[model samples]
Target: EESGSDSSQKQQSSQKSDSKGGSKGEGESENHEYISDAKKVMIEPIEAAQLDINHVVFLDPGKISITCPKDIGEHRSFIYDLETRQVVKLPDNTTVLKKLDNDDLFVMTKENTEYAILDGSSYTVKKAIMRPANVDNSLDISPDGKSIAYVTDEGLFVSDLDFQNPTRIVAAKREGKVFDMELPRFPKWFDANRIGYKVVGFKGVLYCGVVTRDGTVSKTYMEAQDATLYPLVNGDYLFRNDSGKGIGIIDANTGQKKFITESLLDKEGFAFDKNGKWVSYYMTNKEVTEENKWTGRFEVKGISSESKIMEFETEKPNAKPVENAVASPDGKFLLFTDMDMTGRRVLYKLEINAEQSQQSQKK
Candidate 1:
């Protein structure tokens, strides 16, 4: 483990440009035709009402769940189906926390501090499990819907769907130590038997690691001054490294790292397309921005080849920067929210005709 100051220095050094003095240019735009073929759809309008809609979670390509506040000061959850373009409100006052691979939903109602697993087909509570004491509100269900992992004041714990035979996978090692802290953030099931979590070290260095259900911690795969780990569909973990200077993917089994790109590493906006074959991130022209300072664009690239597939500029000058960009499950649509100058949050979807775009590139 490295000291907090040392880690901060290393992170800054990693972000500094190398001796060659790399050219500060937004490399040649690739697949320009792809951008022309894509279309933007307004899923939700910014001026619709006084409602604050957020927590958009895609259950699949066609279905999404979101949280909206009610007039009574309670939070209501609903699922929107793109196929029918209809939003169906959930029966309970709970908001969805996670949608399992089996389509089951893990939801929490803060009013009663209760957690339940809902059936995918019936939209009914399949089971109500025992709530952990001093819950950190970090919960994740396994893809197979058999196991659930969460965090508590004591430590990280995992149990079967029925909440039987619970096991404390990671002890609260920082408890009672100097600079003690609260529960970890985003304790998630990496696979059926393995989980990953973030914890604060002695010097406040945030460390992320994976552990087995039996309570064995794996070697720390990666660490940074600040990093949030998101498990990919293919079992790899994607995280911004070097204090948000770059994004990298780590092989869960081998601990090998492959950076997607070092350019625009300072931007905090990026997401993998639904199929995980493509990634879209926001970027600004280094040369142009050095002169103008208010210009930026979005870049889409192939994950394996690390090749740019398309690039497009936002609305410009008055363009609202995109935030929380996410791809639909099928990879055809990119969804994100942007707040206008008037402070209105608008949700937009970019539809990609990938097949047509590729054909155009070949021509």
Candidate 2:
């Protein structure tokens, strides 16, 4: 079982946890944008429960990573062991970023200026990196977790595992960015060779841009409206619109756009199952007529293949939307969340695969 840590303790600890049809090239494809609201298909989840945290990520089958809210008085992030029901606290004011292969996590300080690697096997700060002041709070680790990338006033920088031997491969002037507040969040590596970042058109519209490691930038395809970039596959990308928090995708080459869920009240309600079989996301049920009640449902679909849509219930009639959805490692289960009248986060479970759904139905 993994255990909690104090500011003084140092060691390792435990626990860790796209679709195709993008364009192929350099010429812009006439600003083709596809917007389709998620088709509503509400099904009762296999199980439902609630949690009291700001947000959470499923770490593995038996564990979860959770960040507590300031009002909750915990003011820290930790790993929650489900079967054992134990909690291991991480450093205060630190956000657990990505879980690394060596049982470590890439962490960003709450200040958003510093980054570090925390040992996963124990309670210890393995390394710390204070980035330049202009560095954006959002970052991404390479798929292998052996490298890190962040943006600063000087454009994009890449470094070994934890900010070691840094080099700026692409240089951007202030005028090229979407905002001057230095708050452009979450730069992603499409693969090892290419990196994707958010940019702005002359009209202040958002565009998801891609650049190769050799300093070659691609013709922008994500130029439809103002949307932030999320990775879907190698060339196609997922995007959350700048307004209304609608979820969509843009072609890495042609810039074509498609909406999965038109809008999500919460930022993290959308997630994918293990093995890339299905995507689960939350969206407001605008069709709901009741006032002062919860008005959202989750939708699921296959990425490379098609599957029956999966959804959760709005049984409680509370006002808050479902906040997040986390998939199990085996791709059989989806753990999702919402809120209660007291403002606590509620968790629910659904079986997506046929075998799991059958067993859950039997039980």
Candidate 3:
């Protein structure tokens, strides 16, 4: 009788253990499980009081432009001077400049008019006589405010403040080639004298290239899957798809490549801080349920190698978060943007604890 009683007790114990294990697995579906132990921080939506109420920031807010009336040509764009609160409209059929530098902007119009180097704040024509007039051109200013790189005639050109002779960096493709190569997209400034850009993508491949002030080209083996380009920050660059797969990093100067994270395999998009310390992207999973609220996750980090640091699952349901986020040059404040109910983008600022970052490094 004693032996039979012991066997029955053991069986009950085993059954209860199995039941507890099953219950724990079921609970895991709802909560976030950190794949690795990482430090966590909670992010709250801080309010952003507008500095300029008259201008609504557009799809690309890196260069803020004043909103124009409906009748204006669709190609025309505006830039607002943050200091003077003046809005300057470039020539008709001209676009607002991207990649702004201190107090100046570079614009290219339908005819390649040379008037790109202009007062960003006052919108006054600073240099029109030097502009070319017949090619679709795009230009960017180096971060140090010393030089400008503009594209025209299917080639990349660099000029100085005086708008002297423009040097052609990349030759236009041989005219007779059947491929009908397109001129490279606007070059992005990695430093005062270096630029990064990609050739047009074709057949599921994008040729990523980097150029310097002296006109040297270095190519990366990696091919971007889509036409959308990633932003450059600090010394690194981040690229992702809409479903968030194929996210990787490249040396901003040398084009060295490394894979950091892989999530949301079908589509992905990303944003980075000016110093390139923080990067955020979206993820999607078809199997997720309605109660989970969002299909994406946002992560921030101090370095590219420390891939998993601060992660927050989406709190709002079916909301589109800003992927064009920017950091103040000092990295003290982070600006978040998104479209409001009317489908217009709004910018918000968040203050970061600079002291906490310093303390964490000491640990």
Q: Output the number of the lDDT-best candidate.
A: 1
Write down the lDDT that model 3 would get: 0.47
Could you tell me which 10 consecutive residues in candidate 3 have the lowest summed lDDT?
35-44
Cα RMSD (angstroms) for every candidate in the order listed: 11.0, 15.5, 13.2
Ranking by lDDT: 1, 2, 3
| CA lDDT, candidate 2, residue 312 | 37
With candidate 1 superimposed using the best TM-score fit, by how many Å does residue 219's alpha carbon deviate from the native? Answer: 4.0
**Predicted candidate 3 versus true structure: per-residue lDDT over 1-363, tens digit per residue:** 114543343233332234234432310111112111111111111112122212233213333543322343344355543324344555554544444546555554433444455575566666553544543445666664566677765577777754457777766564655465645665777676667665652333346556677787555435454423455555566655433454666665565656555554233224445555555455545454445424545544444543343333444455554433545455554444444433434444433443232111100
TM-scores for every candidate against the unseen true structure: 0.70, 0.65, 0.56
Clashing residue pairs in candidate 1 are none
RMSD of 3: 13.2
Clashes of each: 0, 18, 14
Tens digit of per-residue lDDT, candidate 2, span 1-363: 112421112121110001013332221111111111111111112111223555566666767776655543435677766556566777776667667656677777645667777777884788777765666766677755677788766677788755667777656655544544222234777777777776543455455567765555555553555666656544566666665456655666667776665655445456665355667655554553346323444456565443324433334443344455667766776665544334445444554663211010000
Compared with the true structure, all predictions reach lDDT values of 0.60, 0.54, 0.47
Q: Candidate 2 vs candidate 3: which has greater TM-score?
A: 2
* Angstrom error at residue 7, model 2: 56
Best by TM-score: 1
